[model samples]
Target: MFDLEQYLDMFLDESKEHLENLNRNLLKLEEDHSIETVNEIFRIAHTLKGMSSTMGFEKIATLTHKMENVLDDIRAGKLKITTAIIDLLFEGLDILDEFVKNIEAEGKESDRSIDNIINNLCNLNDVETTDSEKDSSSQLQDDFQYVTSIAQKAKDQGINCYEINVKLEESCILKAARAFLVFKAVEQNGEIIYSNPSTEDIEDENFSDNFNIIALTKLKKEDFKEKILAISEIKDVTIKDFDKDSINLDQVKNLTVNTGNKIQQNNEQNIESKNDQSESKQRKGKTSKTVRVDIDRLDNLMNLVSELIIVKTRLEDIDTDLKGQNMNEAIEYLERITTSLHDAVTKVRMVPIERVFNRFPRMVRDLSKELNKEINLIMEGEETEVDRTVIDEIGDPLIHLLRNSIDHGIETPEVRKSLGKSEVGTTKLIAYPDGNNVVIEVCDDGSGLNIEKIKKKALEKNIITKEQAEIMDDKEAAKLIFAPGFSTADKISDISGRGVGLDVVKTKIEALGGTVEIESEKNKGSKFIIRLPLTLAIIQALLVTVEDEKYAIPLNNIKEITSISTDNIRIVEGKEIVLYRGKTLPLINLGNVLDVERKSENNSKEIIVVIVKKGDKDLGLIVDNLIGQQEIVIKSLGKYLSGLSFIAGATILGNGSVALIIDTNSLFQREWYS
Candidate 1:
């Protein structure tokens, strides 16, 4: 016996893919209601309905069935596309999304009723009543199986047998088309064992709107009725439990047929031959080229590669002692293999950022309608790929930033017109690779950040003093929006201004080992620039030592290394500063910050300083020794040592020793620097 649950995961995965396709195509249709878009939407919806019915998700199957009908009507030029209709479709999509979520969690359809949405969809096509009135008073014939052996096999396979009686609307003109649609709908849930008036007679409109179908399906009686009734112009659907045991094989075989049987049989054979040839051509035309791997499997592979690099480093250390040519060669070979393995793993984990960007256009559309603001979102470089881990964590922060732009950055059409700006505001999200970092910028052309308003809010919240506000430059004032619980909006609304400010976005982006910066000009617009590393698993780092402890600094942050005399250091406003390139730079003592004791009590004549850049600010880190540069694999310090502010992560060195990776961004937050 075949169990439907065995294929549940595959069904869910394919269903999700179809849902995503539906969302994308619907958005396209909303933009331009072309016939091509409508046809595509209808196809996706049809596929989803079939899959849902097969999986026993009656609500989803019914909802999609109704949607398919509406789309079919639109394609046939029976209905005009309108904003209200599009919104209703979007609402239907939202419910389907929820259904998928429920299926993911509980391994079955959600218990929530979608009757209201179904009614709306049906009403769009003037379908007054969607629910079928069960007329159990009239039952189906028990000995009516066309093929007794197939019916027995279907029963053995756990497929429930059903006989459906469908009635079409009185005003339905294309009777043949509606009957064909009915057959397709029934076939999606199960195989049709027999149809009254014969399949050919029904297709030829040999009967009225009423048709009877004996189907071998896994769907329950009520579920099957719902699936059929969901179709537009489907006046009423009646279903009865078909009993295979009660079917008499001898009686079914003895049933007589006339000359019509010869013609029907000949037609079916020709149709089957054509279908086989089409299927053969399709199979030969396409190639299976890709496979979906679990992300966890890739993460495990990355971990194994990291361990191998560590072992390879240890081997090199041992080879150095032997100094044998063969040993050196073997170690070098191992090094090459490990390097190649690392690169392969990194590429495997790389995913395009478009996965995160694809969900925004629809969001922006909804926001525009809600805010009464005409805004156009232009996205560029969506194909830029980054680490999957980075992609996963970056979505929410980007969503928050985009929402902030929609709510605060972009002005209303009326306001834009008043300012002599174009009535439609433009928001742009651009991404590109800059060295080892992927930079994403979200910009808007509207009334830019109001520095004075932000200052006033900060001052009222006591986030900054009045004196600070008076002396703050435009850039500095713009940063105040990131303060916790700060908002310039006069009244709180659902869109924003409920006390949670841009601080959340800042916190999340930084948590992903990235940084966010603000750039704004009054009445010109604002840009939020986010810089993130390509991958966090492996990186080239500059190793330095402070006393006996070794530390690694990201080479990307290091601008230059120089030896400066202690006497060159100067004190300005009670802060240690250095004059480099005719500019004063703050100097940080790495040893003191790490609380490491000095190796030599005797004062060294020259101090080695590393100039590092964080955004527009530069700081020179004072360390005891420079250990050159090396590629290292980052490892977490576990929960016990998790909160160390200055340490980003730990990495295994070439000699099997551990080195702490420095968090350069945190350096600026230290009290010594502030």
Candidate 2:
């Protein structure tokens, strides 16, 4: 009577975890082929099989079971690990992954044919068993010999060895659950040495109504049968003494032969195992010491912090009015408490970037093989943490960057060799926390960005005016790749030539309040550096006024604040420009950009300019006045005000006024200056 829907989330989560483990370990196995890696993969497959079987995902369970067998054969040294074997295992892993994805998306596995993978695995397993050093007879003899040894040991320890046959009703549902319960019941009293049709087959429900287990216990045959039959849905129970004389080689061989037939029959019936609530509870007890808090709950907590901001603001106002030392002291204490609380909440929202990094190695492996290039992807600082919301988004952009590197940055083995470089190109994904931001760098050791080729491509695509291209430096030319529909590839391919990747990387990163920059040297290498804010919820902002309107600029993006005489500003190419530190800085009037009302003209001799940076470029924003800095909580302007240029979001001021937060990254766009 267990409801499968209730445990669907747990099932999907565990399935994803197991798939990640399999992918990581399989990649390791491909390189090392160590016994430990093989064992770990086998354990993962076994657990996935059981979980999928219990969840009634027949395709997933079937595929994982086949994977388990092959891994087992490899573990037993019956099969030698080879490139072909590893590739085949990866193929099976892919199919299982697809099945899990299908189940996750549609609440049931896709009808995609897994027969090819299953047959391939079976062929491999068959080759190991029938063509190994030990023949089929020897394998059976080994099994019996091991069983005989265990039985002899049991007898010497004054324990009775009995073969217990368990039969379920023909109409029984959830045979796996029933069998698991029966196993649990018997194991509570004794140890199970072996099971006909194999314990794996029974757990996967790849068996008929009856299965037999050999048990070493002090209980008599009648007592064991009585205990087993006491359970519901028990059609019958039979027990017999276990000894060497009872070991029938032909019978065991036939049982092994018929297991495939039973699986086929069961699959035909579309039999699904029902969820076992008790087993789910057992799993819950053994989980790691962490809770999966709903994201909505975290959002609620953040909202509460926003409310606390209002309280803190009101306290500051009271302190200002009372003009007393005691009031000031109370406000200071509250400030400290609120600061600590904010840090605690930010830490709670932070999660390791490892979750995004783990999937890349497998991707790199696949791409290297596809492009016929040799790439060694090195990842570092995977333990660096970012806000959970950022973690969810940052993965796709990283993928696009890595894929772009593999396809466009890294050279093929032959090309690399001819260039007098090592055949294997290195692509590194590095991440680290820097101040209030996280910096991720995707670097490659290959042919660097060809500035000339980029300029040529830009001209051909009309992405840059010839006049501008002629005057552009190598650094400026290299950035042309990020322009929409700009690519240097000679021919179009599935991987890159559509010229959609880097632009997406730019747009998405900027949307997340982050910035992307490229550093490249011709004939050397290229590195794409992305800087992202640690959290999007709250931040330190420099509040500025333009006319009567107020705006918040992220403090991290502000390089410096300075005053410039009106005479220093010059009109260049129809743009207001100022020379700062010998560099021509473009100036944008914040009041004009936001269309704020100018109540009166400013007659001041000096203009207050806020210099903000995006990547290597800087722009000066002219504001009416600076209101110092404040810790502000960013609230979304919601869908109605979404896609508003220049305004990233809105924040509440201490005086209960709403100030728009500036999207500094957007200010660097060419359209903004134009």
Best by lDDT: 2
C-alpha lDDT of residue 465 in model 1: 94
Q: Candidate 2: where is the Cα deviation over 4 Å?
A: 132-135, 147-175, 182-193, 204-287, 323-326, 497-500, 670-674
Give the CA lDDT, 0 to 100, for residue 599 in model 1: 57
The alpha-carbon lDDT assigned to residue 118 of candidate 1 equals: 85
Model 2 poorest ten-residue lDDT run:
257-266
Cα lDDT tens digits for candidate 1, 1-674: 65888878788888877877888888898888877788788779878876787678889988988887777557534577888778888998888999988888998777888989888887767742222113211112222333454455556656666767788999998777788788888766556766666654564477887876667666688877887777788899888776656445443432222112322232244223557546756776674545678788998899999999888777766745677888888889999999999988898899899888888998899898999999899999999999999988998888888888888888888888889999999999899999889999999997788778788888889989988889888987877787778898888888884124578888887777788889888789889999999998888899999888999998877889999888888887767888889988899898888888865663877889999877777889998899888888899999999999789999998787899999888887765564
Lowest lDDT sum, 10 consecutive residues, model 1, at 130-139
What TM-score do all the candidates reach, one by one? 0.76, 0.86
Regions of candidate 1 where Cα sits further than 4 Å from its true position:
1-12, 105-111, 127-287, 318-321, 497-500, 571-574, 597-602
How does each model score on lDDT?
A: 0.78, 0.83
**Which tens-of-lDDT digit does each residue in 406-494 have in candidate 2?**
88888888888888999999999999999999999999987888788888888888888989988998888878888887788898787
Q: How badly does each model clash, as a count of residue pairs? A: 0, 0
In candidate 1, which residue pairs clash?
none
How many steric clashes does model 2 contain?
Answer: 0
> What local lDDT score does residue 364 receive in model 1, on the 0 to 100 scale?
92
